[model samples]
Target chain A: MSAQDLDGGSDAEADGSGEMPKPHTIRLELADEPGQLLAALAPISDNGGNLLSIFHERGNLTPRGHIPVEVDLECPPDRFERIVDALRDAGVNVIRAGAEHFGEEVMVILVGDTVDSDLSDTLHRIESSADATLQDLSLSAREGTDEASSARLRLAVRSGRVDETLAVVRDLAAEKGLHVVEPLAEGSQ
Target chain B: MSLRLAVLGAGAVGGSVLDLAGDYGHDVVAFADSSSSAVDPAGLDPSAVHDRKERDGVVGDADPESVFDADYDVLVEATPTTLGDAEPGFSHVERALADDRHVVLANKGPVAERYADLRALEAESEGTVQFEAAVGGAIPILSTISDLGAPHVTAARGVLNGTANFILSRMAAEGLDYEHVLAEAQDLGVAEADPTFDVDGIDAALKFVILANVLSDGETEYALDDAEVEGIRNVPGTALDLAAEDGRTVRLIGEATADGVRVAPRLIPQGSALSVTGTQNIVQLETKHAGQLNISGRGAGGPETATAVLSDVSRLE
Candidate 1:
């Protein structure tokens, strides 16, 4: 969340090499409580998302009777998913997000030493190496990491890079002695 | 949940909606045409009303004005297209929105000519306006843009007018002149008897303006006059032939750009996305991140257009 660590996320990155930040707009439904706007804005700034502007439509109420808020921000595409997650984690209702999500998406399951292998680092490496973005993830360690823990990952990769992205994950999983359940592989029955 | 419905303009589109609403668990509480209308609190029989209108030339005892006051959850406006001021269609939408009723518009007038006004009305009203049938009859183009969100659609363009496309396609394939093909289209009911609106590119331009406004997310509210329109009326068969020699075909393409809306006949390579023939309509959206999205289907028909209207109704909360 540090400004100095802008390129730290697995979704989008701005390496301070002068890449123009991508502009995104998110439509939200917020309770008309005091500090709701601030509570919403905190996660955006926390995730290295540059604030562009916010239009809190005080007069208009969505179907849920909550005030409609439109927030415009600029960030690298790689970091957008993280910013979205941070907003949701902060309990902000996101009705709409950035339009330019990755075109192709795939789901894979990894079983074996998930916690010990450092899932966050593995996700970051896959996104950075394969030019893929992590979307939704589910981790389960019911039997504890000593036996086998499984994690389900939903990834949004650039079109035509699904095979390569899966390969990157497979290579990393091989080195870590983790078993990968491939869903996007051509030979998968 | 059964939806109480009020339908305006019981023409091809409206009548079709009346016919199919029951299948979707929606009841046409009130139905209106230009001359006579029917308003019922419970539910109106679609067959009885349609038969009365066609057989006896009268729909019901109530006048069109009474339809406005009818109790209903949603107002389906299927009126004919009237450019310029957009007339009764615009006023119908305004009244429905003001009365806190959701509106599903198959008419192009309110959305195309009066987009900004409609947006203001929608912002103030509890009810929302959906017009999937306005642009592409059953192609789901407008809603697709909404689903994709506004900022991502960098540019959108396509062949919007089926009548124009039909005429041009026939002229290209059969080696017939524009006049001959247009006459054939009229006989086949593919083009209107007057055919001025479609051939002169005004119809396509209106739909293009609507698409532009929707894609921009109201960043740009393009008026009918703002578009630079050149219809396919003057297109000759020889031109299509010449284009065909180079593996190209002439099509009436309506495009929305950052500058403004434009409608004209352009030569595209055969088998390309925009090279659709006959009454087929194609919409292609150039997105910022999701690459390009292309949707094509029948652009206009009684059942096809009504299907779009019914889809909008089902989408209503």
Candidate 2:
């Protein structure tokens, strides 16, 4: 696949295909070489990743004396993981790889019958729903699966999609008979 | 770099590949059908050979034997599926692999009937074998599980045969008998006139064998006979009706585990993953890390099967 500089603004909004291209930033520690930056960018472009920008820190160096470069690219959700995989396969050292603007994260608590009702499937449904991705998950079932228990989930949603993502989670929780403890808005004094 | 290809069997599957290979950056340098064959070091005109076959039942002036010496990087085997010894197809693959040329198979015969022998051939040969189209026409079933890594994939189950699944689904939804549905499926070109391989579960069993072997990671060798096969021929409409009463649908599911492989009609709960209708085929992989990944799509079609073959060609190193 060839990469095109995805025309115009944020590709995060759904294209006519009904699938959004998420913009992601990848931080990499590259050895100081003539074509190291070029080598790293090849994989991103080859695996259907659209080049957005490159923040090549030629003036600075990391502790190990390697230049740290951050690449900004956009690709469909399905293609993002593959670009990362291809980059790694090409021997690029990735420091951080994720969405650049999942600007909001919410921690929701679920209580009652998490395990017996299939918690894994519920989480799977939320992620596959495409509005958000699960950032972290923690479950506390001290008593037992049969008894009431609570699970914590940190969901990373697009900047403007926090409410929509939460609504999906709430609906899924309601169907499973789980109580939702919504995370309060930031800085409530 | 564009790879040169020599396609054997020149039927629908092979013809589609011959017709569509150029769009995917593959050049068909040579091709062979039953009666005649053609070869060119640069590239063959796909339309020219197709027209020849349509008019004269042959592809070219050259004999079929010339395919062995054709100048190509990958040899595509798209012959008919044969059981037991897996004749001409096996010989075709053996010849290609022995020459250290990569092979892509849409034919189920060599892989199903003689997996052990084929594996042995692949072990010594410099070339590799890819058969994604053999199991599911357009769905990347084998490549998906294989790319997920064999260790991660624990089990695989799916609705593999479109014909059998179509027959069974229509019987349930229409409340029709097996014979009536089978006839309807045949009329719709979903089932072949000689539908024994599909209805008797041999086709599904062959796919399960391929899946089992792929999941085994070369540790286990599974032949067509290794699977305990049961077709949907005896599946009565009454059984489907009884299943429907309980909010279930009967589907012919092919399952492969580390222990064994089998194909039989099983009742799945409504809205379940395997409850696909018509000619859709689905394969669900049970993985250790990731959850079940279900891939469903057209199981068999000329262009679809050719696309799988071309995808394999593209992945050939």
Candidate 3:
């Protein structure tokens, strides 16, 4: 894949094809070095897939401080998922992996003393409660106190689960004194 | 999350887009031709047009407002190249933009004719109108020109169309007339039913307009009309002739100079990356520091065009 840039990666405008028979777009973050693309592609090829096209944007890194790659391949709809598991076994940071239309985007704000209050727990709760990925994040810490910090989290929630995610955000905010900016509504602004 | 896409035009290009979008498994709202653009009051599919219906297919909705009725993050435009014509499909696109949906267009007309208006609405609504497939499908030509960057993109040029190049290459190789070669292309779904844009160089010109608009910073007096577009119809006998005579192949190039840009057929030397770019699409961008960077790939079809659209989705992060 490295020798040919024919491995997985995302380029939005395309006829989604893949090495596997069933088509899915897997977003991965890998160490910026040699053979990373090859390592990712191996799992898909081994499982099921025809090498459609891979856009391993070496220049564009993912949220995990690694290159964000998108792979489009074809595979049996039933067997298409094993490739993702195989990729995980291969020790790649599978940030966001799924059939193209499965992930939903959600934005939430975390409030309260995040630094002192173990912010990792908040993130975990979101994932567990909402079945989503923390696609992007921006945090603001005022002065040196953990009591006054906030984070803007842009999440890729599983599709049709936007309500579930909003419910989780509401619950977490109520539990932790956090404030959430509801998406695109009147007061959400 | 799966994106619910409804392609309003199911031509070769639009059909390819629908096929690609459907492959994503996100609910393909519908795949209908723009001429039959409609919306269902009760959740109609976007890809339904004419008699081409399958099991569980939602027919066209009488109105196109359903595209905005529910919600869609990305709206793909793959209609024909009809710039400046107040077509219903163009109105549908405008409606999508007004509804604040991100758009990935492979359609040539709206971007070429209404770039400034579209740019204004994009800024006002914070929605993105990415036309990567519009200019050169799967070639990343828009990205290449964008790589030219602000204040740095002084000039540019390229072999923009793969379909045209393929026809010309075959004409040169087999010594066939235009009609024969074009008919073969039409049969294979490479050239459209009406191959005026590719033959007359309007397609390249429209794409050049998009490139100039996206890359340029100031209000330059650049217009698609300013382009000196000359097609393969005028070029005498194969690129092979040009290659042998000038040691280069005749390539349909969209060259943008400082304060001006033009789309014309040029002679590219043998062993050049542009020369090596076979089949449907290829792009060569001469940047300020990059100097002669070439990106070649599928320009048309479901997978390649969809790949270009997928790139736009990747950048959403």
Lowest lDDT block of 10, candidate 3 chain B:
B40-49
True contacts kept of each: 0.00, 0.00, 0.00
Whole-model Cα lDDT per candidate? 0.79, 0.79, 0.61
Docking class of 1: incorrect
What order do you get sorting by TM-score, best first?
Answer: 1, 2, 3
Q: In terms of TM-score, how similar is model 3 to the real structure?
A: 0.55
Candidates in order, TM-scores: namely 0.63, 0.62, 0.55
> Model 2's A-chain: what TM-score?
0.48
Clashes of each: 5, 0, 63
The TM-score of chain B in candidate 3 is: 0.82
Stretches of candidate 1 off by over 4 Å are A1-189
Off by over 4 Å in 3: A1-189, B22-25, B35-51, B54-62, B144-148, B238-246
Put down candidate 2 lDDT per residue, B1-317, tens digits, no spaces.
79999999888899999999999988999899987899998899999998989988899999988988888899999989898889999999999999999999999988888888998999999999999999899999988987899889998888899999999888888977778888898899899999999999999999989889888877888888889787876566655654565466667788889778977666566677788999999988889999788999999989999999999999994
A12-93: candidate 1 lDDT, tens digit per residue: 4433424456777666778998999999999999998899888675644655778767788898776677888898899988
Give the least accurate 10-residue stretch of model 2 chain B, judged by summed lDDT. B237-246
- Residue-by-residue lDDT tens digits, candidate 1, B1-317: 78999999888999999999999998999999888899888899988998899897889988888888888999999988998889989999999999999999999998888899999999999999999988889898878888888788887888888999999999889977777788899999999889889999998998889888988787778989999787875455545655565466678888887868978776566788787889999888888898778899999998899999999999995
